[model samples]
Target chain A: MTAREEILSRIRGALGDTPSRPDVPRTHRQQGVHRPGTPELVRQLIDRLEDYRATVVRVAAEDDDAIGQAIADALTVRGIGQVVAPPGVPRAWTGRLADVVVDEASIDARTLDRIPAVVTGSVVAIAETGTIVLDGATVCGRRAITLVPDTHVCVVRAMHVVQTVPEGLQRVDPRRALTFVSGPSATSDIELDRVEGVHGPRTLIVVVAG
Target chain B: MSTFLGMPGVPVRGPAADTAVGHLTGDRPFPAAARDSLADTQLRRNLAHATSTIRAKRAAVVTEVPDWEALRDAGSAIKADTMARLPELLEQLEANVVARGGTVHWARDAAEANRIVTDLVRATGADEVVKVKSMATQEIGLNEALEAVGVTAHETDLAELIVQLGHDRPSHILVPAIHRGRAEIREIFALEMPGVDPSLTDEPAVLAAAARTHLRQVFLRARVAVSGANFGVAETGTLTVVESEGNGRMCLTLPETLITVMGIEKVVPSWRDLEVFLQLLPRSSTGERMNPYTSTWTGVTPGDGPQEFHLVLLDNGRTRALADDLGRTALHCIRCSACLNVCPVYERTGGHAYGSTYPGPIGAILTPLLTGLTGGDDPNDSLPYASTLCGACYDVCPVKINIPEILVQLRAEHTEAHADRHRLPTAEAAAMKAVAWSMADPARFARAGRAAALARHGIRRGKPLLPLPPPLNGWTASRDAPRPSAESFRDWWARTRGPSS
Candidate 1:
């Protein structure tokens, strides 16, 4: 018999039709927030992001000009001279940037690393965990866009912000690549001490638009 | 060699193949191994400091969550549910992964799993492959197998890199090289890694930078990457890797072909079910509200990341572990090492003392069950006795595995199986029987006490005689045994409360 058949038979032999799941009591907090843009919960999200040393920028949901201004300001403040995006990100968000290079999935991994920062729009955001999810949408670019660069600036709209991971999962396209960033690239492997900037982008900036 | 149906890998077993199992198999019983580990003050200091830091961090975060216990219960429940329905869930997972343009392989044991992976890397014809830190790969000794075939595997995780560079075994689950300090780390990098800066200090940032610079060229050029999945979601066939450094992301996304070796127990029912683990694991393992990065992919995504993906479902000793109803709950382990951090024995002796791929409370129960210590000559038989049964492991276990209860059960199993193995009645068993008989009756107990006192008369200054005799020598080997009191407590009470008084 094939290994799969033998293994499946073994599992069947081990647990012979004994019902064991009905007694699993699951009374845990499933959703910390069901609504989006609650001031207190957003503040909580900001608190978590800052705790992990990721910068957060708040903006009005529909104000493209303000979103543009926020992105430019973040890049300038960090001295990120060259930025890369997928070109599907609203031109308004890249307003007046001197060295913004927008290309959609055409850049090679080698040259992609030369850029100082990456700006993209997120598919969903989780407030409870302070996470931003990229579903490889046109605006989100490919997986390599946010990864190879040293800085990642993701724009999350209020409607896309969810209270729990489950709610956030509901919005993402499961077939596409999903990168969940809670903070900048970090590691605690060295003596279990938290040290940032290992391989992926060292700095993460989340622009939360309400 | 046929490529029609599923990847039907081979099965490996028996004592002859023990060496094929690599570090997962140990030669010495836990006691002897622990003696060596305990002798190293450096190891003791490292284990004490690292375990204490993680323990405090875990407690602080777990205490902050109002539903920590509830989450733990739900986590355990979810795992149990997954296991009960594992056969069906695994089938579903296989189907989903295949549908997403990924190949799925079934490994019956360690040797077969190594064979499948080695062949896959060979097919790619890449002489070198970068790897994400994976216990499944380590357990099977995949790197050594690859090396024998002239393929080099580079460990990319910072801790794993430290272990590989130093030619040492992993000492902790989370921090594999926790036994090494900053100074040792610097020395390893300076001696091992080519092009490392001469001025590199023991500072973590400087160390991290040195690694980043060193691994960048390799990550960019590598065509094949090997990994282990934290969770295989049956709902979407998505494999998720939760990691801090970008090494995991680099391996998963940069390579042309990606292969993941996952234990059958790592599967969950659905995407929604992922929330519980995502929340429970970070807080319980790393003591973070959320990990720095979590990368999830369903399979091939046309022009992005690895175009060819393969999922190898491993069942090395899992089916055997699943056979026992009382001991099977151990399969629910998430490999978080929370039990190890909080275990007093593990904190003192470190992971090497356990003498297995897994260590501490989990390894104590797990290694024996996996290896099947039904009788004599099993190195893992002594592991069940390594713990103090403090229940700290169970308390901190995210999935609520009752480790203490299982440890006691295994001890009983070991004793009963080996009871008649000897031709002569051993002094230890004989002494136990005598003690039991004496304690069963009041008069007999008094007589036994008198006998003990008479024997104690041979002692000098309340200490047992040097070079003590059989069975008694085991105790005296560690410390001098105190002589018995002249009058038993029972006798003293009887005389004082007698009717004549």
Candidate 2:
């Protein structure tokens, strides 16, 4: 028999003639107290993002121009001169920034590594866990665009914010390569002391637009 | 890999016994190994500090979730349900993965797994590969196997990189270099790492930045990456890797070909099961609300991440563990390392004493269950006796594995396996027989108890513990022997109430 067949046979034999199929209880809290995009949920999202030491700037106006201005301001504040923005990102979001490199198929990881920061729109954000899900959609770009840069400035609209991890999972497409980022890359490896800013992004600035 | 010739119920011994070999065995028994580690004051202090900090962080986050107990119950039940249907789920996983343009290979043991991975890297023509932190690869000795074939594997995670550069073994599951202080890490980096800044300070942030600078070029240039899965969803063939550092992202993305070796037990039945594990894992490990990065991929995605994906489903002793009725739940572990943080014995002796890729309460039972006790002088047999049966591990276990109960069961198996091999009863058996024979008769029990009272003289004055003679000295060497009372309870009861009631 092939290794596959042998492994399967072993599993079948180990399980015995009658395998006990225990019923799984899904009674853990599936839905939060408030709905996905409510004021309370957005506040919780900001709180969680801040807990991870991420910078959360709430754009009062949901228009493209206001979001663009906020992104520009964040970049200027951090002194990041150049950014790799994906092709599908709203032009208005980075219109004010001096140097915005539109992400494309031709850009390799080395090119992305030279860029100072990446600005992209997320698929969904979980309020409870402070996670931002980025599918390899047009707006979110390929996985390397956000990964190779020193900083990530994600734009999360209020409607994309969910209350819990279950809600976040429901919103994501399983077939697409997905990256769920909670905060800036961190490690507690040294003496178990949590020091943020590892290989991913030294700085994560989230712009939560209403 | 050597093929198994034994029948289904026949014990898997001989060649099959060595199949699961890697970092799973200790050269010495647990007591002997623990004796040396216990003397290292630095190791003890580091362990005490790290475990206590993680325990506090875990407790704080666990308390925030009102339905924590319910979540644990759900996690435990789902794993049980998955184990019951492993063969079917694995088939489903393979089909889904193939449908999505990914190839899945099944390995009966570690040697086959190492061979498959080495071949894949060779096919890529990359002499070096970047690696994510994976316990599976460590267990299989993948790095050494690759090095034998002239391929260098660069460990990208901060803790793993430290272990690699220092030429040291990982002591903790999450923080592999938990035994080393920041000063030691700085020294290693300055000495071993090429192009490292000479004035590197011992501060963690400064050290992490140095690692980022060191590995950035390697991550971009790598053609192949190897990883281990945190969970594999059988319904969609999606493999999940939960990590705090972005090195996981770099490895999962930048490489042209990605090879993941996952233990067969890591497969969950459905995608929705991740809702429970993702919630439980980050909190249980690193004591964070959520880890900084969690990457999930389903087979091969066009124009994003690695286009060629290979999944190696490993069954190194998992089937042996699954065959046992009560011992199978050790497979339910999500690799959270929560039990290690809460274990008292682990805090004292550290992970080196356990002598496996896995350690603490989980390793004590898991090592023995995966590799069955081999009668005479097997080191795996010592693992089950390494625990104090405190049940702290069970309490903190996210999947609620009864580690203490399994430890007791393994202890019984050890005794039985040895008894079958030897003609004469062992010392422990003889001692138990004497007690049972004396207790069976009331008059004889009294005589024996009165004679045992004479042992009180063995205690040195003012010293709490009584050191015993050679036969029982090994037991008392680690454990304290309390002084025997001058009079037995049975003798006192007889003298005080003779013919009264």
Ten contiguous residues minimizing lDDT sum, candidate 1 chain B:
B7-16
TM-score of chain A of 1: 0.90
TM-score of each: 0.94, 0.96
lDDT of 2 by residue, A93-173 (tens): 999988999987789988888899999999999999899999999899999999999889999999888898888999998
The best candidate by TM-score is: 2
Q: Could you tell me the fnat of model 1?
A: 0.63
Write candidate 1's Cα lDDT for A6-98 as tens digits.
777666666655637645676776566457667766777788888888889999665888998999999999887788988689999887688
- Given candidate 2, what's the lDDT at residue A171? 91
lDDT of each: 0.84, 0.89
Interface RMSD of each: 5.8, 2.6
Candidate 1 at A66: error in angstroms? 1.3
DockQ of each: 0.54, 0.65
